[model samples]
Target: MPRADTPGTEAAPGGRLRWWTELPLILLVYACYSAGRLLVRGDVADAVDHGLAILRVEKALHLNAEHPLNRLFTHEPWLGVPADFWYASLHYLVTPLVLVWLFRSRAVRYRAARTWLMTSTFIGLIGFTLLPTCPPRLLDAGHGFVDTMAHYSSWGWWGGEASAPRGLGGMTNQYAAMPSLHVGWALWCGVMLWRFGGTRATRVAGVLYPLVTTIVVMGTANHYFLDAVAGAAAMGAGLLLTPYVLRCARWGRTRAVARFGPAAGAFTRRLTGPGSPVAGPVTGPVAGPVAGPVVGPVVSGGCETSAGERFPRQRDERPRSGAEPDASPADTGDGAPAPAR
Candidate 1:
């Protein structure tokens, strides 16, 4: 048996974690993240204003990293094409690959890591809903930022509108640029690889993956510097909340089992029929020896003895004088004389 406290054996109340169960859960979270982005498409004007506001803040702080990176990628085809692919493809690919790696190799940490990623993704969605900011590429032509993904669209599956396929661009919410989950998920993947990966090469990849992802997002004009910062901060918040989320899940599971366990048992019993072991008690004499002291009358010496009499025929004292003596063993209880012993 796997010990409950063991690292890899730790699981939800339902049962040990299995890939089949975990897959649906992951897909569901992704579905929710995608659906949330589509649902919370805030006003385009407001999104543009938010985007401009972020630019102003970056200028004030002297952190205008996006401009030069965007310019470089735009002017150079080789860099721009690859960076666009990185922005469009790796955000979806690398995160899940890292998750699968953790699930297989570091089972003990997979749950918490998965929770942090999911929690952070939802937080990003909330950011999108509250402050939908336009990506730098979508800003006016005067902003000097180029949409590298659009410029290099002929080389890839994505359309000019965004990362979605040619005609499916409308299905995506392009205004959800405030907190870039692209960067956040990459950071998650990087941390997992750095912590659980035993090799030096894995550690190097861990450090570089998120760093490059941040640059790619900026170079492709998909996210601003502050957006990447917010993404990391969201991941941090998710990490802090992971324990509480797990506790609540366990609590809800316990409550559900307590509420419906007995009814479910009864339903099973009914299905199995009365003859089944779990259905009901036995009706015939039991085969084993009597369990405890018998509590009924015993027949001895032609007289009935009450309960608790261990030796029914034995007496403590002699019979009274002149009264007929107690019958001998050879004599019958009806007063007939007995034969030889």
Candidate 2:
């Protein structure tokens, strides 16, 4: 179990979890991800070059899965329209839904899961900033890949530029495609369901969700095979680093408390006002002191006490023979009690 001071460990008073605190943290991370995509719009020429380079490598390795899948989706409207919806909607919808489910149902595992997701998202942001590659759909027409989201724009709310709503595509960066977070987030959701979700239905959904998401990303021409591979790799790296991130957070929290706890307590007391019960010294009636030592009842031999008795049971001091034992014996044992002097 994580310490209460650790990030994501506790939010509400008395170390209880609260959705209000959690929702803001999640929203902040997502906002940063969105802002990152908008800010790190790399040069179009550079992005295109990077995308073409990936294509050549995929060709050499015989991993050109995106082309055939893109072609099939392009030709079949039935498949294409739904794939666009999955691309535009489920990527945002399902991941958060799974997160909410975990928060509500699997509270014990929620912190670690949320941390892993946030860490992976930041890692994906780094990939976008460093090596922005244009997605397959954004490639030249000669590449023979169709942007299904754009092709089926009439059937959905998304615009031709990207998955963003109509007239909002300009806000999105079409070239931040080196690591597809769509697939990465889907994989995270799948793993969470598989590991923490105890039902057979949830486990099945877990397996299919990521698999179908990978297909949808490629079939929609939004990502190459390598892009999907990189996304999974980013998640793997995030999983490996989560423990260390948590440890660092724990250490920092410990230091902060050690350094500022007293001051913080004082500040809180001031805020609560001088008459606040917690800030004021405790007061009540006082009992007069006793004159001498107060002793508890003594137990005779063979008398069984409760589990946590401090003193051992005394030995029996009965007069076994005709003579009576001394009132205050020097020793009490199985042997004869000490005789009077």
Q: Identify the candidate with maximal TM-score.
A: 2
Off by over 4 Å in 2: 1-15, 261-325, 328-341
lDDT for residue 130 in candidate 2, whole number 0-100: 92
TM-score for predicted model 2 compared with the true structure:
0.76
Which tens-of-lDDT digit does each residue in 187-272 have in candidate 1? 99899888878899999999999999999999999999999999999999999999888767655654465456665433333323
Q: Which pairs clash in the backbone of model 2? A: none
lDDT of 2 by residue, 89-119 (tens): 9988999999888777767677778889989
- What TM-score do all the candidates reach, one by one? 0.75, 0.76
**Worst window of 10 by summed lDDT in candidate 1:** 286-295
| Angstrom error at residue 31, model 2 | 1.2
Residue 295 CA error for candidate 2 (Å)? 25
User: Could you report the Cα RMSD, in angstroms, for every candidate shown?
Assistant: 13.2, 10.8
